[model samples]
Target: MTYRAAIVGTGGIAASHIAALRGRSDVTAAAAIDVADDRVHEFARNWEIPRTFTSLTDALASEDIDVIHLCTPPATHLPLAREALAGGVHVLLEKPPALSLAEHHELISAVDSSTATASVIFQHRFGSGATALRQLASTGKLGKPTVTTCDTQWYRDDAYYAVPWHGTWAAEGGGPTMGHGIHQFDLMLSVLGRWEQVSSMTARRTRPVETEDISAAVVRFASGALATVVNSVVSPRQESRLRFDFEFATIELVHLYGYDDSAWTFTPAPGHEELAETWGDLLTGRPSGHAAQFDDYYRALAAGRVPEVSARNALHTLEFAAAIYASAAQNRAVSCTELTSSSAVWRSMNPGRTARAAASA
Candidate 1:
């Protein structure tokens, strides 16, 4: 059956969703909704959407939509996600699903009790290099993956933060750490299995907002692997990459600007023929991007199977994020289990408190 999808935001990232949905014969942009009237009209006209709504409540009340894509900012996700789940519409949530761990848990509970499917947008997981890396790691070709590193040195100028909600703690959650760095963090977690503990530090190097513009973290995985993440929004230019080290092999993934079909170097330490063969097997498939992710989501919806990028899957990533921030705030290593179980920490970071800080800062 064809899926009727409605896009809720018309910002820059929403265009990526629109492009991914364009050619799918199983889905169409049934409607568009945004607070900005011009954005709503322009996107609807450009994408050939037949209808547009001024708000999410009005759109969710309509009976035609089968899938709802939440492309709104970080601060606005939880309430809208809960609303869509209540409306019995499948959700394609954008990155940094919520501001804190408790919100992520609450949203997961909402999705679990509802009949709707909820998935987050970690588009990098669909890229060829990343997909290949995950496959090799899963097959034990990496030989007990011991170390992983992620570098997200991207530039966002003063103009980029000109928007009212761009860099504030209340509206945007955190700086590059949560807004941009979360992507590679999610990808790192995807490849290395699961994080057990994290210690992080965030700084306001360039941006004047209350949230940090630069941050770094050291993560320990459940399997005893070490991982490091470097996130920044004032790097002068954009550069993105990841590298993994194992007992018998090493792999390097380097890309810039955005995800594209790219090549990676798989180096065996020595006398590991099986590891080399495993890498060879992984590289045989064609590269994929946003289109592949959407295709997978659509297929899952059709077969009544849970999507791989489901909200529950994303909650782990969100838990890792909250642990990092809490470690930075408390100046100590934080356990993922503790971070996920404590709801008070998340309550402090909610808009109720963060909103006051943003107003004063």
Candidate 2:
């Protein structure tokens, strides 16, 4: 059965969504929705989408859209997803699924009540290398992750933030930590499992934006593995890197944006040379990107199961991001359990700013 899909928020990312949908045999890119009528029509024309609407409501009302891909800003994710889910349409949201844990919870509640499912786009986890790493780590083949480092060091100049929603806490969420490095760290979390605590620091070094231009964190996982995470938009030399050191082998991935099997390297420790063959066999599939994720999502729908990176599954990564902010703000290590409904970080990732605003008022 071919599912009809509507692409919402026809910005630059919508093109990726459309392309992914087009690549799928069981899905059709039926409609494009955006607030700007001209832009939406242009996007539809460029992508050969048959329908266009100025809003998701109009698209839902007119087109028989089975799923809606929300490629909008961070602040708009929850409401748009709620609307699509309410109409019994599956929702595939862009990264940083919601602005805060509070908003993410609302999305979770909406998904719980509706027949439809919602997934966040953490495309890195769908890669063959990441999948192989996850399987190896889970099956004790990697011999326990000991030390790790995840870094997203990409350069985005001042002009990049000149876009209205590019670097604001209210719109894009929180600079590189929320918008950029999330892909790498989310993939890290996927392979490493639950994170226990986070201690972090954030700074607005160069960019004249409301959010931090860089963030660094020390994360401890439940398995007693220690990891360092760095997110930056100010680096001149750009790279996305993740390295995992296990007792039996050392695995590393170095790439920007997306990764194929070539981006990964596995070094087996002495007496474990056979693990190289296992890694080679496991990492022989598609690259990490929207197309791979969309393929898996459709398969989940066909199997009557929740898709990978579902709203619930994605919450851990979102909470980990929030914990970084909370730790930076409070100047202490933060536990995941601390970000409850009553916590200020739950309402806004930048709780320090919220507190200062309240004090002045």
Candidate 3:
């Protein structure tokens, strides 16, 4: 059975979701929603979407929609998702799910209280190269992970931040660290295992916006691995890549232009012969990354089982994000538990506060 889907935001990122959905075999794009009426018509016309609504409430009222893909800005996700879940629609939400872990919890609670299946989009988990690397890391053959690093060196000009809510704390949440760099950050955590602590630094390198345009962090994992992240929108050319150096092997996945199919290189450590055999299994079809995640979510929904990428699992990523911010602010290492606990600092740093204050000023 084909899942009927509706997109709640029709911006540039929404176009990617529409494209991915259009390419999927078991889903159909049934509707599009955006506050701008002209954008709705343009998107629906260009993508062949059947129904268009300016109001999310109206789209949620449609009985045909089984899944709602929320492509709205980070700050707007919680309320819109709450409304959709209340309307009995499964939700595929975008990253940095909300402004804080508190809001993330509220959304998760709402999903648990309803029948809708909810998940965040971490599509990098779907790449063939990502799968091959993750398999090698998971097995003891790769020995133990030593270091992993991710760099998101993409360029965004003045015009890119010209949109009213582009760089502020409240509207967009954070800058490259939370926005552009998060895909690889999630990937790093997946391969290196859970994070035990994080220390970060953020600065405004290029844009005059309210949020920092660049950020970097060093992380220590529970398994004694070390990792670092560098994110910026100031690079002259665009590049996205993740490299892992393990005790027994080194694997790197490089994506040249945005999020298309990527290329990879794997180098086995001296003593690991058996681990190299897994590359055949990875290339043939093991399904451990993004595609595997998507398949797992679909199967669970069909069989009345809980999704593998559950709200709690999604919360871990958010907690890591919060730790990054907290680490930078406090100028010291921050624990994962400290980041997820009830705290007034994150609520005060909502980033959207600047936008709201700007309106009043």
How high is the lDDT of residue 30 in model 2?
A: 88
Residues 205-319 of candidate 1: C-alpha lDDT, one tens digit per residue: 8776777888899989999999899989988768877888988888887766456545467788879866767677666454455676887889999999999899889978877
- Winner by lDDT between candidate 3 and candidate 2: 2
Output the number of the TM-score-best candidate.
Answer: 2
Error of 3 at 166 (Å): 1.3
* Inter-residue clash pairs, candidate 1: none
Q: Per-residue CA lDDT of candidate 3, range 83-180, in tens?
A: 88888888888887877777888988998889887788777666666666667666667778888888888888999999887887778777887777
Report the backbone clash tally of model 3.
Answer: 10
Whole-model Cα lDDT of every candidate shown, in order: 0.81, 0.92, 0.77
| Pairs with backbone N, CA or C atoms under 3 Å apart (clashes), candidate 2 | none
- Ranked by TM-score, the better of candidates 1 and 3 is 1
Instruction: Give the poorly placed runs of model 3, Cα more than 4 Å off.
Output: 23-25, 256-262, 284-297, 348-361
Worst 10 residues of 2 by lDDT: 16-25
Minimal lDDT window, size 10, model 1: 343-352
Model 2, residue 182: displacement in angstroms? 0.4
Identify the runs in model 1 with alpha carbons over 4 angstroms from their true place: 284-288, 340-344, 348-361
